[model samples]
Target: MARIIHALSEIAQDYDALFCDLWGCVHDGVRALPEAVAALQDYRANGGSVVLVTNAPRQRASVQRQIEELGVPADAWDSIATSGDAARAALFTGAVGRKVWFVGQPHDEVFFEPMKLIEDPVAIERVALDEAEGIVCCGPFDPHAHPDEMRPQLEAAKARGLPLLCANPDVVVDRGESREWCAGALADLYEHMGGRSLYFGKPHAPIYDLARRRLTALEKDIPDARILCVGDGIATDVKGALGEDLDSIFIAGGLAAAETKTEKDPDPDALHAYLQREKIAPTYAMGKLR
Candidate 1:
């Protein structure tokens, strides 16, 4: 059974570094959570290094700007490692072709800059999968809704046996009071249609490996057991930590809050059952990061 705690302070001293999640644990999409921000600040003030490991489909600099815009303090984290960075690096070294069909929002265009790849806009709109050598999915074109509109394109890509590169492996993220689909959801749909996908984010080894490198740069000799991952998403954050053999702190009041909370408090039984269903056991469970 996981220990239920009210604040991250309870376990802060037990770890030397934190591999923290960005979206849910640190802030909602609209703004930073004051308590969460304070907790992170406090943790850093106590000499612990923090690496914001996010599945955001943009580079670390872009994500840092977004976090600043969302009111997160600059000193709250030591460094950042994003899935987009990992994906770009992988694509740069991989055997994938240069011509690609990009699927995602306008902001995601930043991912293509380093690759010097040509994007077929017409192919993306017309489902002309054969026109491109590969497909890069940063996220859903419209994250607020279902990805049903992408079915035709996915089917077409599958028929052509095109390889897909998914930057973010998060299926859904909490956006203020709502939830939205992410790139992982679209990649899952594509796989369901028998298309092959290469993922670069959480629940995958690449992102974790990138985060560890960043952490090591910040603080030398911080072992995996000394690093704790704190996040709300069971499949991404918690599962990713387990995959990397690191300890985790599950935030019950973030993405899973709706189903795991009773009134304003985290329902221990509900949270436990949910974790059991997901087949993950976090080292600690807390209502909020603070």
Candidate 2:
């Protein structure tokens, strides 16, 4: 609990490349943070390569389209890597031919576009279970009006002893001005009921490996010594960076800001303690990316 904030520009000198996080770090869901967006612009202008890594369960192309709509410069980064792409890859190689019962939003079905989609509703149709070789949990739901909304469905999947594939395993996300439960909630509940979930997104090696591949495809060797990762969530952003052996700068102004009092500097003491609880040790910590 040091309660220390590092100057962004000052640390910019130490890293040649930066892996930035979306959602909480750059935007609160509705609009993009002017300062955070500016920071990436500044970093890139300084000849540093930036790769925007996100746990969004959509393809990189779709995420990029959304980002461009948010006023973020498309040229700000050298590349973009998304969890959806990784999930699709898993469906092709790792879980090939597995009959998947996806429990998520209709748009998220794009992630399972590669899989042989079984559209029968898991909640209403019992026969869907008979056809399912595995379960792909995407989002909990748009508005989680009730916990049992997905509980019965999750319970059913668990009882069937079907392996779960969580495309976007983020428990929660800052959607506009509110925090809503994501796909991870269902995945967690399934696992609690003795079900296994293979996460294909952030905080996992497959996602990072995909991002690394994108970086290498640029035809320029990344100077590993000068690379850095900036993100919000400890489970995905920070943890993903650590898993990839990259120095990470945790931006606590997003989802974790709720655990603090002030939005500007958020209680560093409490944040440090929270990180410790999550077993995450970032190289640098900041209240916001800017």
- Scored by lDDT, model 2 comes in at 0.74
Candidate 2 is scored at a TM of 0.88
Q: Clashes in each model (backbone N, CA, C under 3 Å)?
A: 1, 1
Query: Tens-digit lDDT track for model 1 on 192-238?
Result: 88989999899899988888889778756798879999988889888
Give the lDDT of residue 268 in candidate 1: 81
Q: What TM-score would each prediction reach against the true structure?
A: 0.93, 0.88
Q: Report every candidate's CA lDDT.
A: 0.84, 0.74
> Which ranges in model 2 have alpha carbons more than 4 Å from their true place?
1-3, 94-96, 114-127, 146-148
| Candidate 1 deviant stretches above 4 angstroms | 115-128, 262-264
Which candidate comes out best when scored by TM-score?
A: 1
